[model samples]
Target chain A: MLTLHNYFRSSTSTRLRAALNLKGLDYDYKAYALLKKETQTPDFLARSPAGLVPVLELDDGTALSQSLAIIEYLEEEYPDPPLLPADARGRARVRALAYMIACEVHPLNNLRVLQYLATQFDQDDQGKAAWFNHWVHQTFRPLEALLADSPETGRYCHGDTPGLADCCLYAQIWNNRRFKVDSSPYPTIERIFAALDELEPFRKAAPPEQPDAT
Target chain B: MLTLHNYFRSSTSTRLRAALNLKGLDYDYKAYALLKKETQTPDFLARSPAGLVPVLELDDGTALSQSLAIIEYLEEEYPDPPLLPADARGRARVRALAYMIACEVHPLNNLRVLQYLATQFDQDDQGKAAWFNHWVHQTFRPLEALLADSPETGRYCHGDTPGLADCCLYAQIWNNRRFKVDSSPYPTIERIFAALDELEPFRKAAPPEQPDAT
Candidate 1:
């Protein structure tokens, strides 16, 4: 059996969980408390060298970190209900949409980056929230524009079927709710999130539905 | 020929340039001066919705954003010198290695993020440099550890052939030089980078070797 080492509230973890659920793959859930520094322990470090969550341990004990990479692995290993598009160009479009949120927004607003801002720059809670919201809006504006403008966009980020970009978008919207970011500005994004929320796979992957949710 | 809208010094652009070089693909280099807010221009934003560097424009006028996604598109379209591994596990390992640098390091230390630190938090050059180095080490230490400890690591990030992870690793080392980061702590990384530097594909794709480099 596989074991998923992650925290419930982590956006990356949420993305991976949705991917796993979408694939109909089951795994043991191992929770790590990020605030308590549980991932920094030697054991967790052995599993994930970066000491970050969403480490997908295979049956052979080969631990794979990086949520996007893990999702790609699952996509490859389990092709049914594919997360990525079949065509290369379509795949590129979906992956590009996914990376826009994964790379541009989430990395800047993740817990560690926020903590670093608070500690290193002495940014207060309001300042941190501002920083988070700033990045969110920065990327979300263009993301919304792209989605709204593109004929390729359907009920989800790509087509009527939910895939990789949907996974990223769904996870990010949940992360935004914690910070109380206004989704009213991105109607396309909001509509997609609502559509995804209606699905069982995405609903089950929500932070509140997780075993370790606070 | 593809049109690559990018900056010479951007780490993501460096990685894509190296990949295109590896694949022996020619592109019309359209330089975006990030510091001058050139990428934020309406013209550039039309090419890339996020206004980010390294947008690969296909001949059909389809613009692909995100360096990794573009590289993957190239890998699928031009599989002569494959950028990823043959097997699922191997591909996962390589992608994980690549994402470690791409998602974790580059996003945090990019030009815009540093400008944000300086403007938003009143961080001086010294503070920005410190912030940059701090992120580099945070990911590099674990990256070095993973590369050093893994038996799968060969001359490059994966096997003897330079691929996706190698492109990311090679570009990041170049980015580090500007920040004057100490590479002594990561001997394996430095050694692999040295090996890669000897290759024309990587050397020609370097920041100093770019047509728009100033």
Candidate 2:
């Protein structure tokens, strides 16, 4: 059986869960409390050298980290219900959309980065929240524009199928909403996320659905 | 002809260039001076709302952003000399290694992030350099450990092949060495980088090869 090392409310973990659900794969979850510093333990670091979340321990004993890498591995290992589009360009587009969130937005706002802000710069809650929302706005504006103007955006980010882009965008939107950051600025993002949240895979993969949630 | 929107020293662009070179695909490199705030100009932002470097404009008018996504697209479009390993697990390992550098290391130390540190927090040159090296160490320790212990230590990042991981790792290590960052701590990384630098594709993909370099 596959085992997922995850933390509730981690955008990376949330992304992996969505991919797993979309692929209809079953796995045991080992929840880590990020606030409690469970991820910094030697055992967890051994599983993922980067000490990041969403490590998928395969039955064969290989532990894969990085949400995008894990997602790609799943797509390659299980070709059914394709998460990426068929054509190469389409796949690139899907991956790019995903990266806009994964690489650009979420990296600057993760727990470790935020902790660094508080520890190194003595940023208070207000400072941290502003830092968080600054990135969200820069990213969300483009995302909103893309979703609104591009015909490629269907029920999901690309076509009507729930693909990688939707999975990524949904997770980012969820994080934004959780921080009480206003989403009224991006109606396109809100609309797409609303559609995705209505789906069982996405809704079930949310932070509140996790075993570790309060 | 494929047009690559890039800046000379941007690590992401270097990765794409290496991929292009390794695949033996000829393309036009349209230089964007990132340091001069050229990327934020309206013209570029129209093509890339994120206003980032290493946007690949395909012959069919389709634009691709994100270095990994662009490289993956190239891999799919031109599979002559594969940038990934053959087996699924091997592919996952290559991708994970790539993410180790791309996501964990480069994201924290990139130009914009550094700029934000200075402008937003009044960081001096010393402070900025400290922040840069801090992340390099944070990322390098695990990377060094992975390279030292894993059977994947390889001449490149995986075996003798120069695949996706090698491309990203090589570029980041080059930045490390250029900044006179103490890479002696990561002998495994340094050794692999030395081997990679001897290769023609890597040499050709260096920042000096681009037209924008002073």
Candidate 3:
């Protein structure tokens, strides 16, 4: 069986969990609390050199990290209930949408980045909130424009089916709500997210529904 | 024909250019100088909602953004002189290595981010350099560990061939050198970079070789 090493509230982990559920693949879950620095432990570091959570260990002892890479692997290996689109251009659009959130927005607001800003730069709670919200807006504005203007956008970020982009969008929207980011500016995202929330896979993979959620 | 709208010094642009060259594909180069904030203009923003380079505009007018996604699209569409390994797990390893540099390190040291540190946090040049080098070390340490330990590592990040991981590694190492980051720490990365440097495709794709380089 596949084993997933992840934290309940981690956005990347949530995305991977939803992808796995959507693919109907069962996996063992291993939880690590980021607040406690569990990922930095020597043993965990042995499994993942990056010391990040949401590592998927294969049955043959190979471990995979990075949520996007892991998802791509799953898409290639499983190839059912596909997370990516069939055509190359459609796949590029989906991947670009996913990267807009994962690489651009999420990286800036990651827990480690926030801590660095606080301890190194002396940012107060309000300052931290502003920093978080600033990136959210910067990314969401373009994202909103893309979704609103693109003819390819149907029930999801791509066509009618929910795929890789939706997984990332759902996870990011959840984080946006947690950080109290105003969603009023992004009606397209809010509408698509609302649709995704009703799905069994997405509902089952939500942070609050996780076994280790606080 | 393909048209790439990219800044010469942008690492992501460099990587994509190398990928295109490796596939023996020719393209029209539209240079945008990042230091001049060319990416923020209205026309560019219409094509790329993210307002970033390198935007790969296809013949049919489908503009693709984000270097990784664009590269993936090329890999799928072109397929010859493949930038990915044959097996699924091998592709995952290469992608993870690439993302480790792209998503983790490059985002932290991006031009806009460095500008934010200077303006918002009152960071001086020294402080900014420290911030940049800190992330470089943080990422390279684990990266060095991963590359040195894995037997799959050949002349490149994977077996014998320079693929997606090498493209990212080459770009990042160039940035490291530009910022005077000490390369003594990552012998494996240095070694692979040296090998890549000797290749015509990589050499042709260097930032200095771009039409916009001043």
First chain TM-score for all predictions: 0.99, 0.97, 0.98
**The candidate that achieves the highest lDDT relative to the unseen native structure:** 1
Q: What do the candidate models score in CA lDDT, each in turn?
A: 0.93, 0.87, 0.92
TM-score between predicted and true chain B, model 2: 0.97
lDDT of 2 by residue, B85-166 (tens): 8888889888988988888788888888888888887788888888888888988898888788898768888899899999
Candidate 2 clashing pairs, residues 3+ apart or interchain? none
Better of 2 and 3 by TM-score: 3
Worst 10 residues of 3 chain B by lDDT: B170-179
How far out, in Å, is residue A55 in model 2? 0.7
The reply for model 3, stretches above 4 Å from the true place, is none
Each candidate's DockQ score against the native complex?
0.91, 0.80, 0.89
Residue range B111-165, candidate 1, lDDT tens digits: 8889899889999989999988999999999999999999999988888999999
Number of the top DockQ candidate: 1
Angstrom error of the Cα, residue B126, model 2: value is 1.2
- i-RMS for every candidate (Å) is 0.7, 1.0, 0.7
After superposing candidate 1, which stretches have Cα over 4 Å from the reference?
none
Worst 10 residues of 2 chain B by lDDT: B171-180
Ranking by lDDT: 1, 3, 2
Candidate 3 Cα deviation (angstroms), residue A84: 1.0
Q: Considering the two chains of model 2, state its CAPRI-style docking category.
A: medium
A18-123 per-residue lDDT for model 1 (tens digits): 9999999999999999999999999999888899999999999989989999999898889999988889999999999999999999999999999999999999
